[model samples]
Target: MVVLFLATSFFCVGQAAKDRFKDWAQTPPMGWNSWDCYGPTVQEHEVKANADYMASHLKDYGWDYVVVDIRWFVENTKRHGYNQIDPRYVLDAYGRYMPATNRFPSASDGSGFKALADYVHQKGLKFGIHIMRGIPTEAVKRKLPIKGTDGITADQVYTTENQCKWLKDNYTIVADKPGAQEYYDSIFELYAEWGVDFVKIDDLSAPIYHEDEINLIRKAIDKCGRPIVLSTSPGATPVTAGPHVSEHANMWRMVNDVWDHWRHLDHLIGVSQDWFSYIKPGTWPDCDMIPLGRLSIRGERGDDRMTSLTKDEQYTLMTFFTIFRSPLMFGGDLPSNDDFTLSLLTNKEVLKMHAESSQVRSLYYDEDKTAITSKNENEDWTYLALFNLSDSAPSDVWVNLSDMGMEGPVKISNMWTNEVLGTVKGKFTQNLAPHASGLYKIEKD
Candidate 1:
């Protein structure tokens, strides 16, 4: 009877936590993440540089979150390589990972990420960090005491049987154990104290789909008394689990790490189609980061270079994501953005399609062309994205007004070029370059 009472109380607390922060993430989050450019070795200076760039250039256009992705706790992570085998992760007494002072010097003197997060907040941006979905294996080995759980230790709450296939630094937490929830609670408490605004939990989403750990993390996020947006990573989050994920997380990835490849962009069409109905105001289906501008500077893929995607393909990438209302996280080196990339990222109309439009979905697709459409809630405009998926030739992409449930004689304007394409009745068509797209805004004439 006592155990049942405790379980009920815990459930109530979790519910309360979610209710308190329901207003967060009202729009798809736009931001920059460190992984695509710097991989596991992103340092304080690098993060600050991007934050500085965003504040100066991108902040006005709603690009705000600055996330430092994986392996921030390691001492000397090689460029393009995660230091999973290194037993030198920085951890607090209670077994929570801390930013390595060697990388984030501001975290020195037991301050954790408070100073860096404060700097980001001062610059009018939110701060986020990446974490693997488990207690550190090193902590369990040392039998560290789980904070907030009297006499319970790390090993007691961990199960070695469910380890991450790629990263061996942490052990999956046994959710039913006495100390498991307490440990997650403690880590989030520290994050709250440090003023973290977002957290991306890895190995808990698609492919692995650690639902139990996701719940524990959600509970911890709520109990911490902060409104941190919870994101789950490395997805293809099962379409069947959409409702469960929406209940627990603000955003969940719909595909694996999206990079500068045409095939990657092509795959997103089907992925978006499957997950379109699941998108809501606070919950989003993430398309992963946009790998444009200068990428792989010192990271996993290669040395510094502009995105391999052609200019037209880049537009298609942005068009697809915005129309689908997927969270946009710029994953390139910010300071190195060329005018073309800058224009793409800052186009207010395209951004509005993402932030204000609803009823977004693919209208039509074929062997050569694909078309998607959405309606703006705040305005009478309808957004249309026509893509030429063909590699060898330009293709004519068409959208019928009747299929869109709209009547004849519509005014259409190319969103990218800002050119009015003249009034059209019945249907509108645009010839797009190979591997390119045309985004148009349609209104009744």
Candidate 2:
């Protein structure tokens, strides 16, 4: 059966043109992100501590990307109707964003980020940063100035119409313009100099729809002569622009900010049902981060916590995402993780399925339930995942391999517990806990 599945997947993609990004995401990309757990309030000290933990402990598992998320470069607050920049989100006089000098005393002037990025690389990991899609309006108004271009107003590069609605204003650039390319090129050159590896540009989804900007950013990265991966945020990218975005970006969000609530997952399963078929290499439909760990909510210390979810449900979410080979970005804090949460994150077998699964696709899903499978390129092994998404305790699930066109006994292993279920006939059966999922490996005899 594994061999058969391999043959089919190969046949489907063999004639297809090579996709640079798809090839990069065969097993999902694993990394740490600040948004889900930190929101817009992440500080340099917090980021440094997490980076240190990841380097010392999680680096061996391929958790390489250390991404510092939003509100990183706000210089002025007057334009946003505030007398000054939020004390929590202030950048220095230099246009670049760095850790607050007092909070992150190690990062003096532009020195901190370079040191952190260097530390991450020295520990055998990659460093990344996140930014909104448009030119920082504050940067524009204050004329803090761009790197290469001189005296160029932010309006000279972007249009007021392209501003993102939810966040403060960001003038969208017209990538097709010659000067526009220079503007982006300069920004990327600075990031390259800083040793940045991945960029997640947000707010490109709604108000200022800059489709060409995607191409421009790719061009800029290429011109910088670095292999930085570009990821877009905040929406299900339009199906019509699929091929275009796929050609440029390594990953794009398939849903808005996903939280630790079941309803968030509930809405995700509904909206992204059709998106599974589109989940191939390079252009991943990110489901956002896993928010199961410690979170700082509403100005309280680990207060504004996540919604109440059973351990089974949380694991079910993780299992489904793993089988999908989706990019796994943990949104929780490392130092504050509990035993159960740590167990989920450190499950080598489960993590391997996500990071090393060869083929990722939904075999079948219906009526608030799903059965997804992932196989390696050679078809020597396969992961068959069964999910029960209700609030009930447990449910029965029968899997049919007839469609795989196999007619022989096969060995199956329970991925989570590492317990082998022995050889079985072509048809398989199992019982799953409610809001739970099972990952099984099937092999032909």
- Candidate that would win on lDDT: 1
258-305, model 2: which lDDT tens digit per residue?
777787876776666666766765667777777777765421123556
Q: How far is candidate 1 from the true structure (C-alpha RMSD, Å)?
A: 3.9
Candidate 1 residue runs with Cα over 4 Å from true position: 1-22
| lDDT of candidate model 2 versus the reference | 0.69
Query: For this target, which candidate reaches the highest TM-score against the unseen true structure?
Result: 1
How many residue pairs clash in each candidate at the backbone level?
0, 4
Which digits, one per residue and each the tens of the lDDT, describe model 1 over residues 229-285? 998998889888898899889899988988899999888776677887888888999
The residue-level lDDT of candidate 1 at 98 comes to 96
Estimate every model's Cα lDDT from 0 to 1. Answer: 0.89, 0.69
Task: Give the local distance difference test score of model 1.
Answer: 0.89
